[model samples]
Target: MAKIEPGNGLKSAESRKSLRGTTESLALTDGEGNLFGSDSELNVYTSERQTDKYGFIGGAQQYSEQSAENIPPEVLRQREAKWLDMLNNWDKWMAKRHKKMKLRCQKGIPPSLRGRAWLYLSGGKVKREQHKGKFEELDSQAGDPKWVDVIERDLHRQFPFHEMFVARGGHGQQDLYRVLKAYTLHRPEEGYCQAQAPIAAVLLMHMPAEDAFWGLVQICEKYLPGYYSAGLEAIQLDGEILFTLLKRVSPLAHRHLKKHKLDPILYMTEWFMCAFSRTLPWVSVLRVWDMFLCEGVKIIFRVGLVLLKCMLGSQDKLKTCQGQYETMELLKTIDTRYMQEGFLVREILELPVSERDIEKEHLASVRRWKETRGELHCKSLPRMHGAKAIMAAEPPSRQDLRQNPTIIVESPLATKSNGEDKERKNTKEQKNGKKNSSPTPVAAYLEPSEPSPLLKDAALLGSNQSLSSAEYDTYL
Candidate 1:
């Protein structure tokens, strides 16, 4: 793992071998990091060029991308001003007018404010402050040998077309490494998940490393717990819940899937696990994430439902999807028409599924799983949906804090300086010839400490993480 490139270890080798012929041909870089050579039409490269504003190497020119007409300048200015005001009075709005906040999220957070807005919406802002310097510490330490190599292999694979990850070990890739490596250190119990790479890569594109690290943390631990864990238990559970919800969302699609014996995980894993980063177009991905950060997993459910319904809901549409292979093929090649950001968001908003509906289905899914497969080993209860409710949930208990203590290795030089200061103080006392009492010798300074002050007394940013539990009963 000394170098960040395609991994060569046993597992990575096995993985590459398994998918070698199935995937598009891969390309390599010369010693100077220029395009070595490639025969695949999909493999396009040039000698170190710049990326467009959206980060794509060739921009949208190759794709003939068509976007809706831009908003009038006056409208754009009004929207920006409104967003600024909301940011200024964020807490007040969340506490009282969160519905308006949700509406704004659906409309689209301004690109300039998107990163900060994401930090606030995902609770990463609060979590980052609560665990100040933790990312640096985790990144500073060497990762588990097993995870390091796996992570290294996947670094260039994420967003390879984007300029951020185009080079083998550019600053973007280095920061991506730091973020992913920090996660493996932060939660060795969970280790690394390949799916996390694209997710983290997208985050790094929008924010700095530390903020991106915390944003990744909040998504893993709070927004979508167990989705990226060792066994993927939560994602599996959600798959069942999604299938069940499909009956209500689009009975025709549900019946088609049932008849074909297609499992939800089959078509949904890449979409759900990576939050559609891989499946959706870049613009749609951003729009969906905007709603996702504001509304939580329910938004995920809505997007999935919309895709399923639009793809397979009608009798006429189902004509082409005659069998298992054809159906899966259609899902793989989703039309860009179904993916326009404005259209998709509007469909998602109009979808009848509510958060309560999702919760009820979740409970029912758990019951079904218990009846058949025995009990699940989900670590924590599902977190509350959306930003306002998350901000309103009770903070973790003191024991939870203790479990996540930060380990700070003291610098040898600093320790020596402290010892010298103590010695000087003792010498002064002895020279005074008054008491000659020696203070208790200091123990080793290398020890674990609390992550943060816990912010029990202070406001978490402008919002409150200490809102009464009664107000947020859904949170656990």
Candidate 2:
């Protein structure tokens, strides 16, 4: 066997070859801070590589003479300039893209570069410039009634889990409401949908109001097509496809899951609703979004597939459980932090496609599956085959996934039993967050002489002041 140097040298020849194509060296400086390579040497190296990689089919001089290509003279000139710039910064750009993926935008994409970076990834630089003025134009418009109504329905229901992070009357909530209401007025056809809140909130961390709104617009119109329809057509389509992909990636887990009547729909609904809000940590979700912008909707599927692969290892540990609920109990305990850290964009690219070798084929199959399901030609649905819950008559909506600011109040009751039952329910809710439907709970069974905090708050908000003691107990 040949001896090998372990620390900085190649472990194997294959590893060296793999790195050769995509990797480049950092610029070397001598002890006295002098550059190593001259421009001529750098130019020669680049010219040879470009010829090998992007294959020149014709000579530029020959093409210039014979061209009836209808290409704009400016476009050709701009293309040449871009090629020169790329050659100049080839190593730096690749290094940055790699470093970006590793660092994972936790502190958020830098402010100044955010717009340009987003534009580059989504190929919307030119389009963004064309419509940049629209932000000011749209800001002058009145708020949409539809958005008001939709916002009303879900505002109180926002942030129903943690009191430390409630959405009630905060600056974040105010900004969210303003942008969402504004966008609804601006684009009446799309109006306001649910998932935009978190996306907007995330954007707001780095950008200003109008900028975040436009970013939201870009994500909605360009990226997540048909995501917020009344029928929830896009979410259901993605859900089915995720289930199919999940089954293939982990056969044993899939078998166990199926046997226990599990499906992706139950747990994975969060993945689609808030786009990984409740599933992954906030940092990981941001990391996923970085790729999501660059790669488009396909990254959603790729991330979902990776998540399912992560979920697979627990199935065996869950096999000895008593029932589906126990299996779910176990599944919920599966740590996702490792998967989120381990699976980078490069690893996602390398994930084995169980159905087809080509990405286009996988996407086409998913699209076809969605269309067929839409046509209702494939009406015979198989029973769930894993440890999962069947979604209720109404699946989780996009709005339910975001935090909003609204309040819920209970009505007064005459009957003693009804009043007592209502009070217990309200007390529980006051401790935890509000229910998805209601804002705050009422303490209905307070003593006749006692004053209630809710009643005091309601009174401050300009409600009726006069009430008898007996009725006041019910009202509070």
| Steric overlap count per candidate | 0, 11
CA deviation > 4 Å runs, candidate 1? 1-50, 58-65, 394-476
- For model 1, the local distance difference test gives 0.71
Q: Where is the poorest 10-residue window by lDDT in model 2?
A: 384-393
Estimate, for each residue in 92-143, the C-alpha lDDT of model 2 and write its tens digit: 4333543443243322333224333443344333333446667667666667
Model 2 has an lDDT value of: 0.46
